[model samples]
Structures are given as C-alpha cells and as structure tokens.
Target: MHGPAESGWLLAALCAGTGAYCLLRMRSGVEEQRRTAGGEALMGFGMAAMAVPAAVFAPPAWAWGGYAALFGAVALRALWAARTGAHHLHHLVGALAMVYMAVVMAGTPAGGHAHGTGIPLLTDGLLLYFAGYVLLAGARLVPVPAVAGASGAKGWGDRPELARACRLSMGIAMVAMLLTM
Candidate 1:
C-alpha cells in the first residue's frame, strides 16, 4: 500500500481551511451559525489531527486512548441531543467512528496496519460507507428547487449543508487514510 504522506497533507489543508471558514462564521454574531460552526470546527480539527503524519507527531498509546475516550464522550453527548435534529445522530455516528479508529490504532503496533490481514469485509465495508457518504453529502450540497416556506429557505446555520460538506471532507480524508492502511 502507498503511504499517506501526500494525501494526508492535502486533507490537513482542506480541513484547516474549512475550520477557518467556520470560525469566521462563528464570529458573525448569529446564534445558529455559532452553534453549527462550533461543531464544524471540532470536526475539522479532529480530522486534521487524524490526517497528520505519524512521523511528525505520533501520539503515545495513552494519547490514543484519551482520544477514544474523548470522542466516546462526544458521541454520548450527541446521542443525548438527538431530539434536536437528525444532525445529532450523524454527529454521534461520526464521533463513534473516530473512537473506533483511535482504539484500533492504539491496539496496533506502531507503523503497522490495523487491518494488515487483508480482511475483505472490514476493508470493503469502510470503503463503501465512506464512498457513499461522500457522494450523498456532496449531492446534498447542490442547490435545488425548494418549495415555498420549506426548511431550505433558511440560512447556512439553519441548513446542514456546510456541516455536510465538512462531513464529506472527513469522509474523503478517512477513505484516504484507510487506503494507506
């Protein structure tokens, strides 16, 4: 498998740029934008962390464990907030995925493949999931005809489009990372 050296850096730049844009939105003094921007910022930073080269700053086992725990907590919080919207459910899933990746990496030897055995099921499943997520999310970002008084009439914060873009980016980043595995 090819190393992630190149793709990782590109993903990092994308995530950082998205995070900066979200931060700018957060400063716009809109409550809904602020809330959405907060989640986007977290996702962007988290993905950036995952995209970094291990040689540059490999975290210790404890750090990985901490990451798993932290994301687990975030997942739990998202679950608790599910009544707010479907986005919360997506957040929970994303956070849980992060936890899974962190725990798996923590258990694996340094510079070793977490799925080195070439397990078709796990590898193919991840590939399909991320690929579908990226496609669906990207499609949703496309502007379409909206019914009058529909939810689509709202601003960026009211809609999940920006958040979807962030998720799509993360999905692409994860797919790249998985390919390198």
Candidate 2:
C-alpha cells in the first residue's frame, strides 16, 4: 500500500498537469471551451489543495469547513447551470463529491484512521462509482477507428473529449484520496 505522503504528491502532479492542459484548451477561442477550462482549472486546484502532503500543508479544522462551503456553493451553481447542458450536471456531481470528502475528512481524527479494504457502504460505494466512471471515461478518450470522410481531426482543447479526459483524471485523483482517508 502506498503511504499518504507519496500518494499526495502523485495526485498533485496529476491534477496540476490536467489543469494545465485545460488552460491550454481554453486558448482555442471557443466560448464553451473557455468555460469548461475554468471549471477544470478549479477542480485541479481544489484537488491539489486536498491532496498535498500534510507535512507540507495540513489544513486546519476551519480550512476543511471552508472547503466544504466552497464546494457546496459550486455544487449549487452547477446545479443551476445544468438546465442548459449535461456537462453542468457532471460538474454538479464533482462539486458534491468534493463537499462530501470535505465533510468526511473534517470528521476524521488528526492522525487519521486505518481504513480496511472491506466495503463500508457509503465510502466503498463512492469508490466503486468513481472507479467505474474513470474506466469508462478513459475508454472513451482512446483513439478509435474513424469512418471514411469523417472528421477525426481534433484540435487542442476540444470540448466533450478533452473535458471527459479532465473529468476522468479528477475522478481517479479523488479515488486515490478517498482510499487514503
């Protein structure tokens, strides 16, 4: 099993890289891409804040509350925006997940508790959900055979596909975090 410290660094690197990629896509001059980039960047930074080594930056009790509040607000915004697009619904789910993690982590003791591999209902269910999502999203991101005369050409930071990859990356990172908790 990997230690929290090691996993923390790994998650940080993964999220940061993913965020940078989203920002790169934002440069495409597409309005939708720019909006998605903003959300992706926020998720990346939020994950980094949650996943960084405790030795380097352990958030105080109040900080966890702050995180919960922030994410809760984001969740509401996403929910409101969901009326227009399915992507917003995904954002709503992501925000709620963050809020859930923040609340659970806040309740945990300072040194943390030992988590068994056995199913614990809620946590384990969430783990399974995220795991399945990551796998499916990753599969979609893979290059597939295109039909003749079809537009298989995708520029940097394309919507839907790139957004899916970013969401998948965040979901994997979130699973890594929940495992350590």
Candidate 3:
C-alpha cells in the first residue's frame, strides 16, 4: 500500500485543484440560488483538502484546524440556507460528511491508525460519503427545453458544463479516495 504521507499530499492537491475549479464555476453561476450550489461545492472542496491530506499523508498540527474551520463554515451556511430557503437533503448530508471527516481526522494519530480495521472503516465511511455526494450533485442536472426562438441550444439545467465539472471532479475525488483507502 502507498504510505499515508503520500496519500495525504495527493488528496491535498486534488482538493485544491478541484476546489479552485468549483470556485470558478461559482463565478459563472452568479445568481443567488445558483450561488448556494457553488458554496456547497466549495465546502466539499475545502473539506476534501483538509480531510484527504490527513487521511493519506502525515497528519499535521494545522490539518484538523483547517478541517474544523471548513466544517463549521459549511454547516452554518447550510443551516442558514435551510432555514430561509430551499434546503436539499443531499447538501445537508454532504455537509455532515465534512463534519464527520473533521472529527475522524481530529481523533486519528499523526502516523495514522492501525490498518485492516479502525482506519479502513473510517476510510470506507469517507469514501461512501464522497461517492454519494458525487451522485447527488450529478443528479441535479435535469433536462430542460430550449426557448423556441432562442439562439442558443436548449438543455436540462442552467449550466450543463458546470454540472459536468462538479460530477467529474467529485467522481475523481471519490476514486482517489477509494484508492487511497
């Protein structure tokens, strides 16, 4: 098995790159309703960065701190969104996964826990959560008709490209997570 330290670095890199991409997409979806989705993506990206590094590489002092901050921020935003607007169960669960990851990372030792049992179970949980999130995000894309006289093509969802990006990035992250696990 590849060492945890190596995995941590890989996860961190994946999170950073994916998160940046999500941020870019968020910029394109500037509407308030759409912006929330972008924020959800950002939460995943940030949590992935914090959690994956701790899971794969040498756990560092600041790792949990970052994770905690990401978790708290997302959790609060999710709650606020839920209270005042359309709340998605998938988003809530995804946010919960981030919180769970933070807790797991905080409890794990620096070099990581014993393999085959404790660590594997936790990793499995993370993998499952990420995989589910990918599915949820992908499912958000639904077919929509084009305007009869509109110049551009009609399709499902406001931005198929952005939805595709979210799915691709999350899918890759899920794969990376499973492999690392």
Candidate 4:
C-alpha cells in the first residue's frame, strides 16, 4: 500500500479475497477452525480497508480515530480468544498493530513522504514480527503426515492447506503494510 497505486489495489484485493475465504471457512465442522476463521476474517477485512489507496479516497483524521477504536475492541476480543488457544495471540498482536498503524496515519501530514511517520524502532519491530510470521506460516503450507490436507468430502473451506495459505497471504500483506508505514 505504500508503493504504487497498482500495488495498493493488489494488496487490497488479496486481503479482501482472503477475508471472504475465511468467512466461508467459518462453516467448518471443527469448532476451533470456525472460531479461528471468524477472527481471521475480521482481520483480513480490516487490513483490506486500510490498504486501500489513499490517492483514491483518503479518510479524514477523525476516521483514523474510528479505526483505532474499532481495532482496540478487536484487540480485546482477540485477547479473550487467546485464552482458548495460543494462535489467537497472533490475532491480538495483529489487531493492536492495526490500531498502531491507524494512529500513525492520523498523524501523518496530507502530503507524506515515502517512509511513513512513526517511531523507526517500533515500525521495525512490527516489520520483523510480520516477516517472521510469514516465514513460519509459509513453512506450514507444506503438507506433512501430521499436517494433512483435506480429503474425501471435506469442503474447500475446511482444507488445512488453504487455511494456512490464507494466513500466509495475510502475513505477507501485513509485512507490506508495515513496510509502507
């Protein structure tokens, strides 16, 4: 999103598509998958909205406040969910990161530089987090005996590989978003 218009559009599409897939994945037979997919879908959609090209329609500073508030609640929800599983902790971090990014964007001037306005160390930490997550999630995409792919009558929504790929895509998108910030 920090790059060209083309890149912003691509990122938006990727995030939105992943979000939609995750939404459908909520119907999975596994209750845990359903819960995880629900949170992930929210995150994916939120990222897509944020990743929209500013050149097209820049939100007012106040709108960024709304974003912060929204993600704040999301972060809280993710925190509660983390009690059930360690994976939800990642969602909590992601929601908090969104809130941080929104606050940063609110402070940026109308005509901003390529390198966004924020504490370099903080931004770098976020970049590192997302990058490492991408690597780990990408590795999980490779199917193994323990991490078997969906078989028989399982729907696309229930496929572990596709779910992992969705998370991987979101991770890559997060890295890109953080880079621009």
User: Each model's TM-score?
Assistant: 0.77, 0.83, 0.62, 0.91
- The lDDT of each candidate is 0.70, 0.77, 0.58, 0.86
True lDDT of residue 83, candidate 1: 81
Candidate numbers sorted by TM-score from highest down = 4, 2, 1, 3
CA deviation > 4 Å runs, candidate 4: 145-151
Superposed model 1: Cα runs more than 4 Å off: 28-30, 117-126, 145-164
lDDT, candidate 3, 97-131, per-residue tens: 56555565566567664233225665777677667
Lowest lDDT block of 10, candidate 4:
143-152
Question: How far is each candidate from the true structure, as Cα RMSD in Å?
Answer: 3.9, 3.2, 5.0, 2.2
The C-alpha stretches of model 3 lying farther than 4 A from their native spots are 1-11, 51-59, 84-87, 113-158, 171-181
Reference-based TM-score, model 3:
0.62
Go through the candidates in order and give the clash count of each: 0, 0, 7, 0
Task: State which candidate, 1 or 4, has the greater lDDT.
Answer: 4
Model 4 scores a C-alpha lDDT of 0.86
Clashing pairs in 1: none
Question: In candidate 2, what are the lDDT values of residues 1-181, reduced to their tens digit?
Answer: 1246777788899998888887787876688778878887888888888877766666787987999999999899899889999978878877887887787777765646425432367677778878987898888899877668967666786656777877888889878876864
lDDT of 1: 0.70
